[model samples]
Target: MLTELWNQGVRNLVEGRIVLGPGLNVFVGGNGSGKTSLLESCHVLGLGRSFRTHRLARVACSGRTEFAVAGEVQDPHHGRSRVAVEWAGQRRSRLNGQWIDGHWEIVRRLPLVAVHAGSFELLTGPPEERRRLLDWGAFYVDSGFAGEWQTWRRAHEQRNAALREQDGKLAARFETVAAAAGTRLTGMRERFTQRLAGFLCDASTAGLREGLPAQIEVSFRPGWPEAESLLEAYARSRPSDLERGFGQSGPQKADLDIRVAGRPIREASRGEQKRVLNALVVSQGLVQVASGPQGLTPLLLLDDAVAEMDETGLGGIMEAVVSLGWQCLATTVDRGWAQRTAGARPDARMFHVKQGLVTSLD
Candidate 1:
């Protein structure tokens, strides 16, 4: 589990670190005291990106151009691990310790899920983003995923550049590249959806089951599957894509049409969308433990995650954390939920935040 996280030069604060244990860790405080900032630091360190904004510089504290995060993990069952992230003088990132090479390498070694307000990006962002999320998790669960994805991505980039250059000859040369990548991406995604579906479980059994027992289905929508082969689709869509100024019909843009109880989640009520996202997250944790060698105690970062979820949704999430023996760090505007969560949890730590600092209220 994450033993501790140290952060500096982040929003609204000078520096801070909080020691953590295996269950629930709650950050409670007024709006601007950096309660959420601490969580953002964890989100940034773990995922290499912040859900709140695409820009890292935006989260930097006033007068500070750099930031750092340190985390310690102990695996009594296997071993221990420690890592730190430091970024100075720019919007870019800096790692202070031995680092993993690529973005996927970092995430695979450190698989952390951050579910904050931007969680809905799953429902709303480009299909490539959603697909990558699953692929990342798949890589975490299976090491071979990265090499497959990388090989395909390289080919796709070359082909896309060729298309942009309006060099049909070059694009044709890379058709095999697009087809291979598209097929693998599609297969990986299909298997993940099926696996998550089979794990169909309710968070309520652990006393957190709420909302409609979330129904989730993942379907592939190859933009032009019926009209052409992967290469043909690229050729067919190339002219219009260049006109649109973006590649519009590739695996890079492929999407999985998600639905909750037959309702298109994007068009569903706010409450429904939140529940579906929650279910996916919880499902993600369950899959991790049940499938990997690392058996990483699923780390769930809930930044303002509950406020938008219903009582059932919140309870369900908490229940899943406890049931799966996963670790959770959540933030809230009020303590009512925290208090209730504490009461329900036998092993949970609570932290009070004020202006970028965190104090454990045990």
Candidate 2:
């Protein structure tokens, strides 16, 4: 679903152009070359966020007005949608040749899955990381879910601050909104996990650890005592909450507990966590395309995520990827993997990237 990418002054990329095909697209590059930056550019152009440490404004050339990425997509091919993300100085962007109100709208078109070293955080980091894992799945399945998510987050913040400030009256009123929003967010999380777990069960799927007997499951639990209404819980926890300067209840404190084989991923072997991460990303992308907006499946972006896999692991992952007919952009340091993957599929396209330049190897 990515027509082409014309990146101008973004991160390591001084100015690089890439024209993509429908199947697997690989970017092969060495260390500081911009391999990851290209993938991050895809994400920023499509999602409005940078994957690396660079600031959004810095994504453009060091001192330029801003960086711009222009490309096309499926469904009513509207020529090229260009996004010029400016530093705080300029402060604006355009989509589909027309000026847009908010930058997020520009990001909807950029649905990318970038797995790098940080993926370890999925299992080793705080619960927020895991919560986000589930939410990405939810966002793909439910269109209105994002708006609900935003509302819930805002309400949660208001309620938490109120409770922290010891304003019982304000916290109580805010609790009403928070409670309603939490329930909705909780339900969405549940729905996404359910769909994801079911998809992994598909025999044609790839990347999951075979014979891992147990399945991937996610559950939501609030931080404090289980109460039917949040207002009641907040009232009960107020004394201690104010003592701690943070709300002890609601989605702010919610946790997404994920278990594979009846054992937590945090406790699982390092390899197991990697396999689980792969499985989750692959399965979610497949389902999103089958049932995302216009049923347009997402284009998978693996920024050097695969080179870490051994031969067998890579085989299983690629087999599933090919079987599902998903469009992908895989980055790697190994030229052999690039050769093999692109060689096997006639539609696959490969690019050689070094420093900041990109050249199609196909």
Candidate 3:
């Protein structure tokens, strides 16, 4: 659980230290009051990137060249530890006062799952978004998956560079390495997706939707023809990849196919799609908590999660959050609505944010 958070020089938030609760923590405020910034800070601390932007420099306040976010987290295995991330022209992260190499180290200490307006893309957006969801689960469930994924990404980049240079010999060598790493990456993702399917099915059956269709199905597309191996697919696509100036057939192109009653998710109504997306996000956290190694439960961040939902939908989502027994930080513009949705949980707490200031309301 996150016990405290401190931010400086981040967007509208110049300075603040928030005491967080163990369960549902809601931040209520009007738009542009830095509620989302707060959540982004947590994301930066855990993932080393802002969910709000691709460039970390964009998060720095105007006239400032640096930003920092730190948190006090208690892991069942690690006990209480201080995790800090600082960004100047570059990023530096430390865990328990010792310098760390990358974001995955922070992730292992503080596993996080986030859902926001953009998260709808998981359903209606490109395959990359769904692939990220799959990879996040795989990263947490299997410790070695991250290294394998990194290897695949590096090889994929080298292969692309070789293709762009029109170096057939170099491309072939990198392609072999890429295919080997991608095959392992694909297997890990496939296994994680299969495990998550059961949790998603259970969530749907347990009233993820009321009048809306609950028949949701999920499948993995390993980014290549199923009848052929990665090496075979790479060979088949070599000519096209050379012409296109990039490698095309590998785990880099993987996707998660979500369907509702035989119809693609894109064809579903916005409300139906949101429910399905919510189920996917929440079930992901459920899988992390239930299947992760001992003493590891993901922290969930929901940015304006209840904006479009009715009372029933809100209740169902909140129920799932409560049932998973994990910590969740949610943002809202309406305090009453936030309270009403999270009030039933004994550990739920509320805060009010105005123009970048946060005050406890619990």
Predicted model with the maximum lDDT: 3
Residue pairs with clashing backbones, model 2: 10-59, 46-110, 289-297
Give each model's clash number.
5, 3, 0
After superposition of all CA atoms, the RMSD between model 2 and the true structure is 2.8
Runs of candidate 2 exceeding 4 Å displacement: 54-66, 76-86, 89-93, 101-108, 211-214, 222-227, 293-295
Per-residue CA lDDT of candidate 3, range 45-96, in tens?
Answer: 9888888888999999989899999999888878889999999999999998
lDDT string, candidate 2, 206-321, tens digits: 44666355676655565556646666777787778767877777666666676787788788766667777777777777666655565455677787856556666667777766
- Candidates in order, TM-scores: namely 0.87, 0.88, 0.96
Name the better of 2 and 3 by lDDT: 3
Model 1 lDDT vs. the true structure? 0.69
Cand. 2 TM to true fold: 0.88
Tell me how far the alpha carbon of residue 332 in candidate 3 is from the true structure, in angstroms, after superposition: 1.1
List model 1 lDDT by residue over 1-362, tens digit each: 67888887788864666789688898888888887788788777777777777777777777877777777755544456666666664433334356656544345445677677777878876676677567755665565666777777787778768767877677667778767766666667666666666554543332332455445665666556756677777777777765654466666766667786777778777777777777777766666666665556667888875677777777677767777777888888788777777767768888888766788887
